[model samples]
Target: MKKKITLLFISFFILASCSNDEDSSIIPVAPVAPTAIHAVLNEGSVDITWTGVEGAGITYNVYRNAVKINKAPLTEAKFTDVLKNTGSFVYTVTANLDGAESTKGVVSEKVILELPKTKTMQSIDIYYDTKYEYAYTYDTSNITKLVSLTIKETNTDLTYKKVTVTNTVVKYTYAGNLITKMSYYSVDDIPRSSVENVYNAQKKMIGRIVKRSDGSINYTVTYKYNEDGTITETNDARDSGVGIYTFGKGNLVKYSITTPMREDEYLAVSNYVFDTKNEPTLNILGFNFFVNNSKNNEISSSTVITLNGELSSTESSKSDNTYNENGYVLTTMKTLKVSSGETLQTRQTVITYY
Candidate 1:
């Protein structure tokens, strides 16, 4: 019995010793650095993605410009950062495991943010034996709202007497940065018209209602967007019209409008061949409903507008534009081909940015 008891005690002691030795040898290891860090530049943001570490219970810390940006360690391997300005930004990510942080993996990128101008003034002067000058002012106190627009027109000859010296004012109201209401007033401070715009959650204009000065609904237009981003607009009083828009490298490439009344079933079409900068032609609204949601008023290289599907060179209107160093339209020469002859028109537009 004593031998047996002693053997049992020895066995128990050996087992306990082995258990303690195994416990003391075990130590927590630091996490490895994140791999395959990538930064994708967007219009006003940057998307960063990386391969996650293999270790369990791993978390990540993201740093921008050498400063930590995330409020807490993130478990996901991807993050999106909204940028305020345009410039170069450096990003680094570090992995953490059990309170131990690994060395950071770095990536650098230059971000060019295309934010809309806050306050803009554009003056266009057209000359063709007669002179017509138009001035437009846009106020964007609220970033998402276009506060007001003032349009002034002057003509040197009364033969082109549609333009007046008095300023026409248009006030805009917004919902979530999308124009919802537009009120127009004549120079005499008389209400001329009011337009109400309705948009879906995607910020695409879905419907528009126009009201004349007498507060009666003059017309209503509804729009539908295809999955490919093309649009079809239908008026309550007329047949539907289709607008086909094409994009290349994230820039508007072409936009064609077709109406039922046209003989060839095409009202107007514009093909945009952009420079390296990918800027489009300037317009009064500073916004292209066909291309994007934002308001960008820049000049284009060339624009051709045809009416009633008339492909004849003698009936189309064409304009060629030149830009200044700041990308503003310096000069525009427009030729209107009439049935009788050709009429040459020149225009100079000056834009001020703030």
Candidate 2:
């Protein structure tokens, strides 16, 4: 009875297993392909927010008059066309995910921003100065702290330090306020540092920066000038980011550039330096990386430096610069430390300009 049951059941079990295997082998059909893309500008540029490609790590191409203007991978979802006098422009984004890419989405937008009026300065002058007074407790320690400061003009020369400190007194002097030919003095009345600088009448920078061991930094910028005194290029070596500057529009605009890291990095970090007041005189940045449960950003690892100012030799104070509405520096504010001691007070000097 058992043998008969086994033989009869074997065939049925085999057929059932085959049927299950066949069912498992059948794959579901893939979804339909994505639709073709057509991009158009909702405002002045293409707005890709409505499409599924928003912030999708997509690659895009911008075109004007059916000719490609830009083809680059976008870090953001938005892109602007700053090309001058683009009559008609179209922007399209292509969604690239995995190995497959979606069809191009296109948009056309019109832009109209009125350019501003320009001017040529007949003559421009910029300068500033600062003085410091220090008071120190000789019995406690040799450290001296600045108690008071006075601002002065760059043209005026500082004679002596009026404050008395424990053992040290510092004085500052000026040959010129151009930031390249300034001078400083010590307690013994010995000249310690000298700074040098060069600029055009508009104060556009074009020079090299040199720091000597005697505590002096010099600036000598070179510019390509027209016979009429209009500038072509203004280059400065004191900049950590910007290197070469190409001028346009009758000295109204400047292109400050950082020396290219590899000649290729120039394309992205290269930006326009407009002659507007919104331009920054200093920029200090830092970046860090961390691993697994550890905070990555660092603080002490970075050294800070001023972008467009002269430094004092003894205390390393950055000089102040004053700007007008036309974006030119009109005056400079500088401070010099004198002396600090237990018995004597500090002295300050203030200067005015025409």
Candidate 3:
């Protein structure tokens, strides 16, 4: 019984000794101070700079109006927002260390927006060439009513051809800002081997359609924004198609079509490759209906055609053309080469009535 008592006393003594030593070694840690924070405003952005907290292994939490806007790692010391619209904004920068956040440095600034004048009518010349010019008189005071668009083309025979395209369109306004209206028209005698010269506007073409003639009906286009403030494109076709685009850090990364269209079997799919400066490296296979509009009946494999920001290597086709000093192509040319390696060229002489 004495041995058992002695053993229990020794164990108790050892336990008490360990407990006291642990209590003695406990040391309190001090809180880190927020340091060296500054904010600057540049042309269209806000720049924030700060120093790292000493021995805190801290990250950053940027808040705008109690809502966390961004989170950065311990290594980062700067952040900038390029989209600062005209409004008063509150900012808070908090320090995070070991899953704990420190008190924030708060700042507030107001963005100023200076917009130019709207709702004004002016006369501008829509020039076809040095010789071909027309005066466009726009009166936005009543944008829904008919605004006159009268165009005159100068011919080589020193004569002016006056062609008029008039329509009554309704215009919407945001206070005084003018909203665009959808327009539709067709052109005739575009020189296609096939007699079908009509094209549907809702087909989503990648290039601009210059009116050579007039069409039957006008198609509509509506623009809207995504939840993330990105643009969404939806067409007004009988079978409507939609697409959303995503941009890389600063460059256009990819665009995807969604809803009611197959990715593989769709009418068109384009992949644009770019260099470091976002200039196009190559346009793999962009399609255009302008090939049918050329006066040439046969297309040769060796023919090369260059348009604004685009190039195509197709077969040489004959064309009949009319040209003017103002750079308006009134007519096309005839095709002479059926096989590759022959060059066929034509010119159009334009005459404008001013």
Candidate 4:
């Protein structure tokens, strides 16, 4: 009668142990890259937008041509960049999360710069008596921007015009209606030299500075206005002397330039006669830097160079011009002469509009 009781045995397996300590080897989640980046140009300004990752402690940064242009991190997904130059730019945006920045995405956009034209001068072509030619191009979209100046040593025939820019000079730059800089370009289109204009309180140009590509000053010229409405240009070079400029009715009637010689200083005085009509070159941007642009069309000129107060050489020029519908000079046939009234050459100029 002993108890034949049989006990059933059951076992439970524990998958995890209950503990108060937490996992210390856990890894953090990284920031996600931005997407759908876009850039738009609005009147010389760039507006950049992107889709950013949603997270805490998030920020954004803007890059232009791979250079960080943003002064500080942005919390929004949009940015506006005011451009000071006219050229193509590469734009990209980055996202930051929890003090960490995501690796830069391959997504990037490019924008070609554009500006509005404010003047009417378009292009000009000059044909010299020696078969040399010069063709100046303005911006196709913005005519006020002087694009490039092409010179052909002997290509006025228009037969073998090539795209060789090895012998070109500086391009024009402006600030509003005033042209401020001329950056000389070398064979590779690199600015190897430059000329800058300084203005006074009334926005009158008072000084001109020339510098080499190495940022060294070559020379400086200061312009002083006189009570009699004349201008005195003083050059800061040992070999150079003061230039006396006499203007009449917004035109340079007489100009004298002193240049250094091996033995004595040479003084060249140029006198001009003008017609009572607007000159086409006056409409051109940055053309007055050489003092060739006159409010009225220049019809005749005489130059006499003296060495040590003695006559050295004499020259003269007269232009036979045809006018346009607006009374602007459309074409000019210039006849140049020597001291003995001998005809040296005849040159031609043609202007075209957009």
CA lDDT of every candidate:
0.61, 0.34, 0.39, 0.69
List RMSD in Å for every model shown.
8.4, 24.8, 19.3, 15.5
* Prediction 2 global C-alpha lDDT: 0.34
Instruction: Identify the leading candidate in terms of TM-score.
Output: 1
Give candidate 4 regions above 4 Å deviation: 1-166, 262-265, 285-292
Better of 2 and 3 by lDDT: 3
Residue-wise lDDT of candidate 2 within 137-160, one digit each (tens)? Answer: 111111111111122122222344
Error at 118, model 4, angstroms: 18
- The lDDT, on a scale of 0 to 1, for candidate 4 is 0.69
Structure candidate 4, residue pairs in collision = none
Candidate 1 residue lDDT tens string, 69-134: 989889999888876443457788999987788888856454433322322223233431333333
**Per-prediction TM-score:** 0.56, 0.22, 0.27, 0.55
Name the 10 consecutive residues with the lowest summed lDDT in model 1: 115-124
Best-to-worst lDDT order: 4, 1, 3, 2
| lDDT of candidate model 1 versus the reference | 0.61
